[model samples]
Target: MTETTPYDADRARFTRQALARLVLCDHAVDVADGAAGLVATENDPDSGPGGRVSQAFQLIELAERALASAVIYEREQGSSWAEIAQYLGIGPAQAEERFAANLEGWNTAFDVPYRLDETGRKRIPQLPTAAYDPAWACEKLDRWAYVQRIGIDAVSSGLVMAVPEEELPSVTP
Candidate 1:
């Protein structure tokens, strides 16, 4: 994306927006990598028909999906249409019109988490893949975070749960 994507604060670490941002970044890297490969093969006549251009083209669609996810996340986080519109450079009504269906679908997904696949045996998640499988997203984003800033220890993401006092072992020395 040409514009900066929003991510949640540490207190809301690994929120949908954060995961969507991670996906957006991943798409960007993919685009860069495909471009590099295209460059590398430019002079080589023997390296023919690798479909690198196709791969990069596909990234645009993925980036759009990622952007929609970001919008949905922003709405979910209680950002008003005007606030989201400012960054998008459109009027609030326009912004809301563009993203309202996405927001609706996002909300509906939670109400109906999954649907039956064509086979009727397999289940297909209604939620976006990253948000649907949050543990995987956390692991991936955590590593990305660690590489970007050492010692953050994003591996320990999410609020810590307290153990029951009665379950504690005896502390006699």
Candidate 2:
């Protein structure tokens, strides 16, 4: 088991797709915030070139996390490997192989929420920071999306999150 941080007794309350969306949105916001900071840095006289360059590099990492979140969200939504591969312009096998670990780690988090650190004492959370706490993610993402001029919720990428199981009315199949 890989090292992790922040293991809470309460696991995620959201479904895989909802959690994935929060992760995606969080990363997306980070990338946007980082880029905006870089732009602001350019106007600051005290800012050095290294500062802007370093922030730009951080944006790359944020963007990569955003991409991974997207892939995880897609899989949870019943998107086939072939469909993702088509968009990625790679063969299905290639796409699956590339992202298998990310999906596995996500799925496993529900079963085993955390693992011991190298010292075998401290517990680490397996889920990403955004997915670890549902309420925080929903509030932050909802407010962010609504204020971002995206308007009301539409889908996973849009504002809002999955309704809690208890909140849903019973459906007869």
Candidate 3:
């Protein structure tokens, strides 16, 4: 017999990706802090003084990549402009503009041989379903609607769900 839970599959995938990102972040920290085998220390007579500075630069570059990757992931997961803006602590218009600019810069700098289709347009993959259960997907739809209804920027990091205050059951205790 097999057991299933509403959050199992999605949570597992999210947990794996989240752990990978954390590992990258931790490595960045280790490099920047001169821990681990990131670079030779000054105690080593042959080591150069530029080691720490270069490692710090690498940390910044890795952090930038992590942030960009997160934004792209959120977008592909059906996050709205407002949700992204809220996460970034910016306005929706600014978020959209900045993301577009960043996407262009990323493509220009990182895309090797230019990944385009036969029509000369960039190829975009079809998005997968957000959740396994259609009923659970309804909650996500409601959350999106709630975000739109109030016209307030709501922070969403793809892990937490924000239930409306009214919908929450009152506790007598």
Candidate 4:
């Protein structure tokens, strides 16, 4: 007879919770990015006033949760000012000024964990640099560029759910 480990149930539950958390976080980011784009198009000098304004308002309503989520995730991820600025495509000072208050409050609310090294510097997990698939990478690059042109808020928000599950392109033999 094989013995079943009781620890397995706890592990499975933890995994599920973790996956759910990640999914929610990602969803938030995506919404925020979408909202930022709508705002930009509405603000565009060349865009006609009527349709663009309505679209922007609609996007804002749709993206509030996403923007909140991105702020929370970035704070938890311990993103540096420079990194955040780069993500926003703005000067570091501007990024900090724009996001610092919101980011701080969001981080505190989420109780996101942080690590401190021997040097007492806080550390964040590095995002994977390699794409799971070349095609997915190309698509992501294009999407990122487009979002980036609108604002960093869009980029940050987009990043929340930007990881595609199909990137690995499962193979069956």
What lDDT score belongs to each candidate, Candidate 1 first?
A: 0.62, 0.77, 0.50, 0.48
Candidate 1 is scored at a TM of: 0.58
- List candidate 4 segments past 4 Å from native: 1-55, 110-173
3 versus 4: better TM-score goes to = 3
* lDDT string, candidate 2, 1-173, tens digits: 55433334333346778878888888898888787666442245565768667887898988887887899999989999999999989999999999998889889987887788999887777788788976777789888777868543323332243786679999999
Worst 10 residues of 1 by lDDT: 1-10
Cα-based lDDT at residue 71, candidate 2: 92
Q: How accurate is candidate 2 locally (lDDT)?
A: 0.77
Which residue pairs clash in candidate 4? Answer: 26-160, 28-66, 29-157, 88-152
Which predicted model would earn the best TM-score?
2
**lDDT of model 2 at position 113:** 76
Runs with alpha carbons beyond 4 Å of true place in candidate 2 = 1-12, 41-43, 146-173
Error of 1 at 8 (Å): 22
For every candidate in turn, the CA RMSD to the true structure comes to 19.3, 16.2, 19.9, 19.0
Candidate 4 structure quality by residue, lDDT tens digits, 52-148? 5676676776565455445445555666768767877888798778767655654442243233467865443221111112233345555765765
How do all models score by TM-score?
0.58, 0.71, 0.37, 0.34
lDDT of 3 at 16: 28
Rank candidates, TM-score, best first: 2, 1, 3, 4
